[model samples]
Target chain A: MSDPGKSSIPFISLITLFPALLLGTIFGIPHLIGEGSAEDLITLSGIGVTVTVTDLLFVIGLLLSASIMAVVYYVLVSKYKVAVLADSKTEELLKSRDFFLRLFDDSPVPYLMVAKDGEIVLPNKASQRLFQMTAEELMQYKFHELHDDAYFAQSRTIYDKFVRGVASSDVEFEVVRKDGVRRWVRLSALPYRKQGGKGKGGTISLLDITEQKAIDKVKTEFVSLASHQLRTPLSAMKWYGEMVLQGKEPLSEKQRRYVQKIYKGNQRMIELVDLLLSASRLEMGSFHIEITSFDPILIVKDIFEEVTKSIKDKRLHIIENYEGDHTNFFSDKKLVHMILQNLITNAVKYTNDDGTVRVSLTFSPDDLHVEVEDNGLGIPPEQQDKIFSKMFRADNARLKVADGNGLGLYIIKEAVESLGGEVGFTSELNRGTIFTVTIPNATEGSGTKSN
Target chain B: MVLQDTVLVIDDDNELRGVLQEALSDAGFEVLTAENGSVGLTVALESKPNLILLDLVMPVMDGWEFLERLHADAWGKGARVIILTNADDIDSLSRAIEGHGYEYLVKTDWKIDEVVDKIRGELGVQ
Candidate 1:
């Protein structure tokens, strides 16, 4: 309150000093009683006291001196108060700055403050630990020095993007530490403005995710090896089992049944392995979507020939409807075939004898929709929600069919979704289920997965 | 009469090789087996079989290498190759086909009797 221009105490002091001057009038009171004249008040300073108790000149001089002292006291007090206030304000600002600095230093996530010139402006405690160096030593090297040479350009681009607030949400890359070890780190960055400079910088935080990446890699490798190695033996068993049934001399009814059972068992194994392959690919997120233009009708015809005899023997009617047989779909042909195969296989497997399976395909400018409707034992209402869940089987589905592992719908769902499509169904118990999948036409547009 | 024609089975799986040899022989075609691609190539050159069933992914010379070597040989050029392989790598399979169109079969997808029938068809027999 005590900047000379800003202090309110000067006005209050002026008022208090004005009232003290009233004592000067008391000096005149003696004169007013006819003891002396007001003009004689100044003569007191020129001579010694004249022995009167109410000398006008003496009283006027005392009152004026006291008023001067009061003004001086008020100004000094206000100045002291202002100094105290400024001291505490500065202290509070310093404390908050210290708090943020400590937080950055103590954070477990490694942080690097990088200048636009690519120099390491500051390194936190975690960064020091990550790079196997002291903070001072870390700052001695540039940002790219802590990273592999292969990652320098990428790191620079990411830094620029981050400073501009345009980088991807999650950025992950590998870096070489000072200890000569490489590790993967997920990075997040924030822009930092220099206090009094035209330069801008970024503070990047790194979280080590090497262990998670390693685990994922091992899982993918194991799946690949199992699929590759298991197929050979399974192939042998299937071939031999089939050979026995196709022998020149026809076996008895009992022997034929046993051989047929073997063949069927092998087929189930193949189906399971293929399902595993798709599941692993989905989980690994490495399923490549190769969009090739092909006539889907030919695929349907092949599948039809494979299932025709069995459908006929069971007295079931199979119908294939195409609005335009010549209409070609631009999509991942293998995945589309898989989607069709799974839905149709489920239809054939779950339906009762003499049931009907109708497959109709509709075309749009942007997508193709295939609907597989079967009057099979449909899923109950409560179980419909979980039909696409892994290893989920309907109670009635299991009762009607005993050999299902419940991966068919899951694989179908994965394959369709990976192709940027949607698969959904509506079903009623003992009536029918209709599965319709809409896949975007890669012909008219671009998708995430194109080889 | 079918046994008059010889077939070479190039595969590393001993048990599968045994079963396939027995099946091919039962179908009346004489069968020769080798455990790896290199051994199979030597046997194939010496025997000069009527047909070759090449298995990919064998050690000491994979099916691709065997085919390359077979193409270089004068006697081997006339032999029809039927790739009986467990390798499911799509690019490799397609690339193998682009050079010389061979009827490739995924072993798991075909039965032994079916393999016999496919071989018979290639040989122009019933």
Candidate 2:
């Protein structure tokens, strides 16, 4: 705490010297003139007083001393200004430090400051509350050590990355609090460096996702329940319907027609249930992607064969234009099936009598490209934006078909996106619509087997 | 004259079991039926059926446990199974394929004739 104004001492001493010099010049000059006749030196009479050399020297020293005093005063005032500035700056720095500390302490999100070695340097109030421990107890453990044993390996990997100055976001972990309660947390970390300090640390933020994870688990369980419960009865109906159609008793024409209708209606009900299950799984993010090798053309052929009745009824022209020999491509079969099935079904259903529907498959090392084109009722421009929405049908489409659930395109979009692909379309009202799908090939070792 | 291959149809639903029994009988096999996995396993072990059409979800000792118990027996280790269930669960599908080297079919996705064809192909029967 040395004085900030201490540098003004030399200026003060110089100012004091001016008065002494004035006196010395006043008294010493007369002696130097020698006691004979002081009038011999240049003298001026002004204001009826004799102006001697000593008087002239004395006036000059007085003026010099006044200038010195003025210089000293300026230096002192400037020094005071500097001190005031330094004070405000220190106060501003302190206020900012307090603001951030308060934010870290009072924030709803749990935060922990970790040393470079992964030790818990500081745990805020929220983190202490989350772990159900005091700050002192938390400080005794490393950040990753607070996690459950089952997640310890994964947690260590993330912490290792963090210690290497790599930032990570939303890595999930399971942790047990001191009260023996399990919690799921998604943590994000960033490297932190202290101002004018040598050590580098990390600032980790945690979000308690236990409740959200529970909700997701429940949703997934519901999907599974719906799949089992709904499909079991549907299967029973289908088998019974098939048995009646294949019974040994001879049937009248009317009876045959009615049985066929029952069979067909049961089949449609099964499809709707399947569609609803797929949509639910897609929305719940509970669907798994299983990659396998298969002939995409065969898939196309199977779909075509399945819809042959409708194709025949409409007298639609079918064209298969496969560009490359990708008989055994690797990708998620379920997603591919969903994408192609929806597009081909829509094309078939919307196309009119004598209309043309073309299925094309182009394969490359990086992408599998599929296009289904139908020269039939194109989507109206007004409803094009909502084409991929769930249970949405175009006005023309609804008018053309009496029975349409409209979940096809929604499932297609969701499945395609999950597979890291894109589905797009081009259509003109009453002219045509072409739906295109481009999916990336699965990387090697991801697929389970070949068929 | 050759002996007709025997097939076991194990399912929880009674109507489904009856329908499958009739269909498989018509398809020229000695069909045996059980309403759940436990009874089906006992029948399979006793009769040594040529093939088993197993349903995943059942009342007593589900298909997974049945498979495990069957594989532990000497005569049941090589038993052929076609998983016939309406559930399209991927985890169970992969487990059945990779663990037991069995085939999986979503019942709703396949017609009875198609399922019969798969069974015939598995049995090498016309």
Candidate 3:
């Protein structure tokens, strides 16, 4: 077989020129060797002179036909090789493309390819279902378009942080669906990278967490209602028990002792119920706060006066260090009172007969700080974390007092947090405990403060 | 003090009321007992007892309603009504005392002697 590209032109030229050569020979040979006898020609040119013009032409024609056949064979072989290579390459490409496309389409989690500019470029079926939008509709929208204005801003900020490599974990945000219903979605994003490390765009995976939030809300409501219901009956029992113990009755010593036991038992039950209710409410986040602006100094004075009636023998030293007359801050008055009352009560209860409990109220421009320092059996370092937990009485406190339900500090912490405040304490066992409460100024509105 | 006047003990709990009646009878005053607020209000009006013990939670009419009726009725207006029940809270106790101007006592808290003393005190008996 001859090479088609190389042999075709040469073969055609040789075939055409061979014909002209044969014709030229046919016309010119007669003049050169004019009608002569074979013997006479043989004498002139020996045995070679016996050849004819027709035989020479036939030889030339046979050579031309072989050349043409070689050119056709080369063309057929080249075409077959090209067709085989093309078929194999196309098959390989189709298989790999189908595999990759199926993997992307069948992903369980909602996956979205978003441009760096926040536009939705490619969204899989799961993504479309998650956003409650059709594929064509999703392509026309952006990530921020899927949520309300406030949530959009928050989501954009989160995405920007993610793109900047500042966010380590997935972010949770509220997003609106096509039906305009809000939902919670957890998003994890990865930056799109090209071969040369250039940022092309990013991809985000979304997971819905709305059901968990609803369960949490319902639990909170249940705890709040139960607490209120329990308080009413407990209040009734406590009041009646007090009246019985204070009644004037001439009775035998045994009867008096029995009555005293019953009164004490009922008192303990009332305390346990109140603590349980508070703890449940705190756990459920059902406590309500009524924020009002009042002088912290005035609150301290009132709490001190109220606590003093219960602490007959204990000495309470209250120090007020406000720079101006209006040492006021916004807070729930009742909650603040309860917080101070709890701290002061604990101070007096833990202190010895004449031990000192000093309460300080300091005011700054941004915050109001209240400190209750008591020189009593201080809590151990190991038990500090458990002190604020419901029904968690420290071992040292248990030795000092046996009647506490271990809910005072827990309730105080919850109340403080509900009022957008912070509470902490420093203690050295056997030395003293200093509890510090820092509440923001009246300017901060009553909202849930996350730590 | 001889039995110069009768006391009406009105309470839902029969045993507790019986104990009060026995104790009050022993304390030199004749005592009458009623199971509910309506019966107690009736006895208070008919017997014209020197003192009345009222129960708060009752079947037909509650102590609140009985107190309202007693305040409006002609016969019960003068009777010294004291609340003797288990509903014992500052709010309820204060409402009973301040709202109705009646001394409130808890049944579980008060002993027989203490109840008698309260009755005698209200009766102006020495």
Q: Could you give candidate 2's per-residue lDDT for residues B1-126 as a string of tens digits?
A: 179999899999887788788888888889998888899989999999999999988887788888888999999999888889876857666665666778888989877888889999898877
- Assess each prediction's global lDDT (C-alpha) against the native: 0.79, 0.84, 0.69
Error of 3 at A245 (Å): 1.8
lDDT of 1 by residue, A1-451 (tens): 2355346555655655654466656765766678774445443455664534445444655677667767677677877687778878888989998999899999998988877654678899988888788988888876645666667876777656655544333477788887789888887766555554434766777888889999977987697679878988888888777767876677999999988988898898887887777776776666667777877778778777788776887788888888743475788888888888888888887778999999888776678889998989999998898999988999998888898889889988988878879999999899989999998888865444622
- Residues A166-245 of candidate 3: C-alpha lDDT, one tens digit per residue: 33245767777888888877777776665655455777777777787678667756654554455444434544444455
List, in order, the clash count of every candidate structure.
1, 0, 1
* Candidate 3 global TM-score: 0.47
Compute the DockQ of candidate 3.
0.05
For model 2, what fraction of the real interface contacts is kept? 0.50
* Model 3 lDDT at residue A338: 71
Each candidate's chain B TM-score?
Answer: 0.93, 0.94, 0.88
Alpha-carbon deviation at A13 in model 1, angstroms: 8.7
Give lDDT: candidate 1, residue B121. Answer: 90
TM-score pick, better of 1 and 2: 2
Model 1 achieves a DockQ score of 0.63
User: Taking the candidates in order, what DockQ does each have?
Assistant: 0.63, 0.54, 0.05
Residues forming the 10-long window of minimal summed lDDT in candidate 3 chain A:
A35-44
